[model samples]
Each structure stands twice: as C-alpha cells, then as structure tokens.
Target: MNPGLLLPSALFSLLALLLPLLIHLARRQQQQPLDFAALRWLGSKPKPRSRFRLDDIPLLLVRLLLLALLALWLAKPVLHGAPDRRTYVAVMPGVAATTVAMQALPANARKHWLAVGFPSLDSDPPADAQPIASLLRQLDAELPSEAPLVVLATTQFDGADARLPILSRSVDWRIVAGAPPSTPMVTALAAPRLQIRSDSAHRTQAGYLHAASRAWQTPAEFTASSAAFPNNQQIVLVWFVSDPLPTTLLEWVAHGGTVILDSSHALPQSRHPVSLWQNAAGIDLLQAIAYGKGRLLRFTRPLQPAQMAELLNAEFPQHLHDALQAPGVAPIPADARTYRPQTGANAYPQAPYSLQPWLALVLALVFLSERWLATGRRGEQA
Candidate 1:
C-alpha cells in the first residue's frame, strides 16, 4: 500500500548522514614522524597516506542507524493500509439491548453491541428522552476513518424528533422496522406544601403564587408572621423583602426547599423561561424569573390592576401552573427517526491516518539507546 507523509519537508534531516563520516575523520589516529632528514627521504619514495579511514565500525553503524531513524521519524510515514474491522455496532435508543438482540441480531454479532441511544456500554437509555445527533459525530471523531460504522436501529417513535446523522464514511445499517417501546408518565408521589409572605399592595404576585400552588394540587397558605417556621419540609414564597434577604430563605434554598422571590427584590441571574403582559400601548411590562428551585417576578413600572388585567385570564393561570410544577416529571415521548437509508445512501470516503505516534515511539527507543551508549563510552574514557 502507498504511504502518506505528514511532514515531507523533514526529510532534509537525511543530510545528517555525513555527520558520522565527519566525526570519524576528526578523530583519525595520529601518525608518528621520524627525524626530519630521514623522514623526508622516506616520504620521497612513499605514496601519500589518506587522512581518514574506517575506525570503530560498530559505532559508525550505530550512528548511521540513529540518523536514519531521526529522518524517518521527522518524515512521519503512515501506511494507507487495509480497511479497519467494522465490528463495532451502535444500538439505537428507545429499543432495549435485550429486546433488540431478540428481534434483530444473530447470536454471533450481538456480542459486540454498543449503545447508540446513549452511547454508553453500561447505562440503559432513557425512555422519554430524545436521541441526540451529536453522539454519532463524537463517535466518528474517536474511531479511525478506515473503521466502518454499522448501525442497528428501529423507528424511534417514542423519542423527540431529531435529524438522522450523515457520516463522512459509508455506514452499514441493519434496520428493524418496528415502533419504539412504550413510555410511562412519571410524577411525584405527593404535592409539596407552600407558605407565602403576602402584601396587600403586591396582591398580583401573591395571587399568582396562591393560584399556581393550588393548580399543582399543592396547599398554599398566606402568613403575616416574618418569624414563622415552615412545617414538614414545606416551601415559602416571599413577595418583597425590604430588609436583608431572610437567612431562613437561603437555608430553605440550600436544603432543597424553594423560596420564590417577589418582583420587589432584585433576583439572581437564571436561565428560566418567562412570560410578560403589556398594555395596549406596548410599553414595558413585568418580567418573571425561575431561578434554581424558586421563581422571581417584577414589573417595569408601578403595579396597576388596570394595566395587568390579563393576570386574571384563564390561560394565564395555566402558565403559572406549568411553571410551578415539579422539575423532574417525565415528559411525553417524541419520534426521532428520520433517515432510513437505501443502498444508494451509503458512502466510502478517504480519511488521513497519522503516523506521528508510532514514529515518536520508535524515536524514543533510539534516543534512549544512544544516551545509554554515550554514557558507557564516557565511563570507559575516564
């Protein structure tokens, strides 16, 4: 097979082949000279002696080998060898490994199964979660280009809709035309209890908390006492804290209890979704925040019932209901099966293989040998 060079320019290191010759000449043995008159008469009859000759033949061979190794290492040669073994199989999600082996695979090839759904060898794929397109891209980067991909999958109707990955190389697909496994709607065992510090002026925010808590089938209470302690791991909602943030509130947040902050207090930065209501003039309206386990909401201007009459709208309460819902509830499964390749869809593309690693390995061995020999020679000289 033809080989590829990563850094052909480094072949200039071959010029170092002359280094051994130069060193041998520089270290030539010295000849003894006789008395001037007698020596001159003898030289008149004798032909001139060469300045350099082969000395320490073994050492010369070793030095030549060292130079060649360095040149080859720098050139970085890689063989365009035969195709890699394409035995690794990616089993898609929404289909359990045990079930897939039963339906699609034979007894022999089933032994080398890797999860395509989650790309993990150990963990089971989530039932309701959607498949990610980036997983295959990651796989492509890890595996060698010559290594072919073999995909084993079914029509993933239960997961979220995602585009099928297009690989750089031709991938063999052994498709099982079947639906996804059934999904279970998971929920919390009991609704959480909520306590609110209410203000008559900020009734809008307080009302939302009360309504949202009830919508989630949880009990919500309004308390006037600032010193009241929550019972049974219950949550507290603060409309506005004019004084320092309640230490109790922070403790509740740290301990997994939610403390919904009011709009009157500046809230921490968060990535929660928010909904806004504006007047007919399209002026600035109130914004809401869902930070960590809690939520914060505030209006741009002073609170007015006339401007935010939509707070009492029926759909608005449902939004609050969704916002207040528990975080880990299982969602409905969505379908992500888009590409079922025909024979024509397959591809075979050339990819580069690097030789630097192998070259480096050999270079290290030669370098160590040279160092060992040089040290021994020094010891002998002493």
Candidate 2:
C-alpha cells in the first residue's frame, strides 16, 4: 500500500530538530590542564584542527530520532490502495434479522444495516426513511473494489430515486420477507368541486374552466363569483385574474388548496417551478409551483382555441384535471427478480485509513526509549 500525508505542510515542524542538536553541542566536556605533566608536553605541536562534534552521541541520536517521529506524527500520514476482500451483507432497515439469518450468507461475511455509517445489525434498525438506490451507490463506492456485497431489502421500500443507479459491482440484491416501509399515500376526493373566482376582464377565460368542470360527467359543484374567494380547502380554485393574488388568497393556497391561475396572472415567488403539462410538440402548456402543502398551476397561454390549439384538443380536459391533481405516494413493490445492479460503472477511490494512532503509539515508544537512555547516563554519572 502507498503511504501519503494528509497535512504535508506540517512537516515544517522538522525545523525544530536543530534545537536538540544545539543543546548537545553547547554542553562542552570540561577540560583541565595538568601544570606539572611532562614539562608542558615538552614542545607544543601545532594544535590539531578542532573537529565539530556533540557530546553524548547515543543520547543525541535518540533525541534527534524522537523529534523526527514527532514531526511525522504532525503530518498525519495515511495508507491507501490496501483493498479489503471480505464479503459484506447490508440489510435494509425494514427486514427482520431472523429472515436474514435464514439466508445462506458467505462464510465469515460481515453483517451491517444499510443505513448511514453501515451500523452493525445488532443495533436497533434505523427508523428514518432510507433512500434505497442512493444507499446502494454509496456502499458500492466505499467498499473495496474487490469486496463482495449482498443487499437484503423488503418487497416495498420508500424514498426511491427517479432512476435506477448504475453501480461499480454486480451487487447481490436479495429480497427478504418483512413489513413494507410506511409512507403516506395521497388520496383524491370522491367528487372534485371547482370554485372559480374571476374578474370582469377575464370572464371569458373562466368560461373555459367551467366547461371543463362539467365535462367530468359527474356531479361536480361548480361556482363562479366575481369577487369572493372560496373558503373551503376541498374546492379546487380556478382563479382568472391578471393582477397579483391578495395575501388572503395566497394563504388559502398554502393551506392545501390547489389553484389554477389565468395565463396573464402575475406569478407568485417560487424558487422552483415545474412544467406540469406539455403539448405534443413538447411546448409547455402549464407550469406549477409548490406552496406549502398545496400547488399553484398557471396556464402558459390564454385559454382560447385560436392562441392555444390544445383548448380544442380532446385531451385538454384530462390534461387540466391531471395538472390540478396533487401528487400521491405509490408504494410499488420493487422487482428484486429483475432489479439486479448493472456493472461497468465508474468506481470511486476508497477513503484512506488514518495512520495517526499507529504513529502515535510508535512515537510514545520512542519517547520512552529516549528518556530511559538520558536518565541512565545521569545515573552512571552519579
């Protein structure tokens, strides 16, 4: 495995090594000249050129080694490219542990819940909704490229993404029998009612919505007023006014009342507006933006056969009905039989393990050895 440093800039601490070297050099050995020794050594030869050296060579070396290791620890080294080949089984949150136990798992395979952190299965199952496809992609990228993965999920799962995710490995997607994920489903009213609030200017436009309401062929309560807005949340409001909506109307829409606005009406403030309906030529017909629990839909063009040909189209009423309908949660069973993961997708580099703890242990050992040597020399002197 290749070793790398996380904080390479911290290596500047190595400059502190000069401190130990200076200390050993400054503590010169005491020298005493013997006055009566051999007549001052007869004739003094040229003083031998002084050679630079530090006292307590062994102690000095150990001190230098200690400082070097300390500097390395500060750099925060890591090891990469070391692949773990163990087999892993990730059980989705809703599945029972007993069901997983019945399945024939690989020998010595590690079992973990497929939630955040891949917590061990021994802990309580996560309660929060799990995004199945997203978690699978995350797990696939984190595990070693050569590691084998087995996923245990129930028939129905909540929080499914829009599309199937392509993964790096052919993950063993296994379906275990268990209770399905709990998700709130949207239920439509038995007979939808229309409440039209139009201005004198847009009376012609309100006629279009009135005609569509009658086209439902059921007893749909249709009411039109020039000024008063409906107070009932169950009624779908078709508002035909070019001016900005009043605060009361905006608040009503926010409280779960769906509104269809005129083409020339000033749009409300929204960060994300979705195109809810489009014509055969892919031209957007209606744009909708979410407001609290409700939705506000606006026609892209004036409700006239001359300007928008869709007004005369047979499918226009159905399209209008669909736009006004709120979205619902459908807990469709995941087809584990054919929902196998596709291979050949790009693989992500595994996160490197930090070498700090191991380095710290070694640093401690070296520190103890240095202290032992320094204290031993003092004991000999005493």
TM per prediction: 0.47, 0.49
Kindly list the per-residue Cα lDDT of model 2 for residues 123-207, writing each as its tens digit: 9998854556657877888888889999887776654432355898888888888775454343454556787777778887777
Winner by lDDT:
2
The local lDDT score (0 to 100) that residue 283 gets in candidate 1 is 57
lDDT of model 2 at position 374: 86
Model 1 lDDT, full chain set: 0.53
lDDT of 1 at 8: 88
Name every residue pair that clashes in candidate 2: none
* Candidate 1 per-residue lDDT over residues 1-382, each given as its tens digit: 6798878899899999999878877766455655676566564556476654333565667778888888987887877766555445666654566665565443334223232433353565544322333444545555666565666666553322122445665667666554555444322224555677755666655666577567767758878747665644445454444454654454333223445554456543322334444445875354444322223344454333564665666665555444445343222332334454323323445456777788788777877777776677668769
How well does candidate 1 match the true structure in TM-score terms? Answer: 0.47
Query: Any idea what lDDT model 2 has?
Result: 0.73
